[model samples]
Target chain A: MECSVARTLDVIGERWSLLIVRDAFYGVRRFDDFRADLGIARNVLADRLGSLVARGVLERRQYEARPPRYEYVLTPKGRELLPVLLTMMRWGDRWEADDDAAPVTLTHTTCEHETTPVVTCAHCAQELSWGELRTDPIRVRIPAR
Target chain B: MECSVARTLDVIGERWSLLIVRDAFYGVRRFDDFRADLGIARNVLADRLGSLVARGVLERRQYEARPPRYEYVLTPKGRELLPVLLTMMRWGDRWEADDDAAPVTLTHTTCEHETTPVVTCAHCAQELSWGELRTDPIRVRIPAR
Candidate 1:
């Protein structure tokens, strides 16, 4: 199988693809609703919806017959992507929010308190993110010159 | 600027880029260490290192004199990417980790308790992660559609 990160992005990173998924998370499942929320063209929304449904991230159910309304619901596989999307929202909140207030806030369902998420290393267990560490791989072992 | 999510990925999602950054977060700097940890190829690692340095995500500082060894350090700009990377790790832990013992775990610095981060929408005060919210652009007027 492809690397988890790459595979995940490959499925999610097609322009407007993530936004569509985001809408599903928000309970906007109708084609028109997705179109309206994203300001995306009908054709693009149609294509994304079809692809997402095909990918098993979404399940389509017919709710109306006259106009044939359908709703998109997240499967376990789709729900699994929540962390990735949350990461994006956090990033947007930190860097893109126009004010002191976060563009989004995360609350623990159990404790019901506003909280911040952190990343730590498995080895040293340091809080990691951008500036916490440094990395690069070099080739050609240098001989004592 | 570009859509916040897309722009964020552009910075974090170059091939093997996030992993390299992940290593950095682990305090693995220098060429050989990264090579050892990631098993990345020479050329690919080299390219990623160069690009990250150029993007101001990392800085090259000589650590030795005889052969002039160098180590990559995270800049403030790079430091800001922490939350995003943390989110990614959280996602990986949830969806990708195989055992109950996740590849990594998050701990709240202040509370000193293992915790999970969440993303909530700014406008609605609803958690955006876990497929709970969707974004609305106010209108469906396509820019490039």
Candidate 2:
């Protein structure tokens, strides 16, 4: 489908794109910062940065003159991606980590509790992690190539 | 960094991969179901399914004999991906959408309200959105290739 969601994912779905954006969320704005934070190759970093700038997710601003260095700042589009990144962080925190360092601890502002976000069904209003959801009966087939 | 949070993203940062997982959460378990719901190319879907199965997120079980039909079901590992998908849907529904046809809607069980599952600060518990977050002053940099 040519939906905006699909379109947006097309731009950001590549290997290191979201992680680069995550670095931006962490306040690593420069090209060098992203390269450092991600350990991504310079070419890959340059390409992803170029794509983000093209998509209006980021804008390149000169940070230095003689050295010809630039910093990337989040545009409204890029800033809009925080929720996605946060969600990834939340998931990574829960399922991927070992005992020593938890990925992140999301603190609740109103309840004063450090918590992870849960998805509740809009229909049932139940917080469903994994086991809570049942299969919907309607099924479709993937066409053979 | 060697953190799993970083590591997990390395595995699942693709756009279609996450979308496939999201469809699974909606109870779309079969290959055909994913193909129809996502409108993804057959080859890409095949590759993604194979990758997910190999990674232990999904399992392929033969359901029919003559035609050798198979169904893709989420394993516990795949089921654990629900929160991550929920967070993405929640974000898309909020800052990204232009109108009432939101990316997705969620339900909360405690109050039985079909409210948006917002990411609030773990400390104050106030609903946090992308526009609200600022960078932590501490700059954590990893290696760059």
- Considering every candidate listed, which one attains the maximal lDDT? 2
Report the lDDT tens digits of candidate 2 across residue range A1-145. Answer: 3233445566676778777777776668877767766778999889889988887788999978997878888887787676566666666666666668545454443454555555445454445544433322222233445
Candidate 1, B16-91: lDDT as tens digits: 7777775675677789888876788999899999988887789999989988899987777676676666555455
Against the true structure, what is each candidate's TM-score? 0.58, 0.72
Best by TM-score: 2
Candidate 2 chain A lDDT trough over 10 residues, lowest sum = A132-141
TM-score of 2: 0.72
User: Candidates' DockQ values?
Assistant: 0.15, 0.29
Root-mean-square deviation of every model: 7.6, 5.2
Give the chain B TM-score for each candidate: 0.79, 0.75
Write one digit per residue (lDDT tens) for candidate 2, span B114-145.
Answer: 55444445454455664444323334453343
The candidates score, on chain A by TM-score, as follows 0.76, 0.73
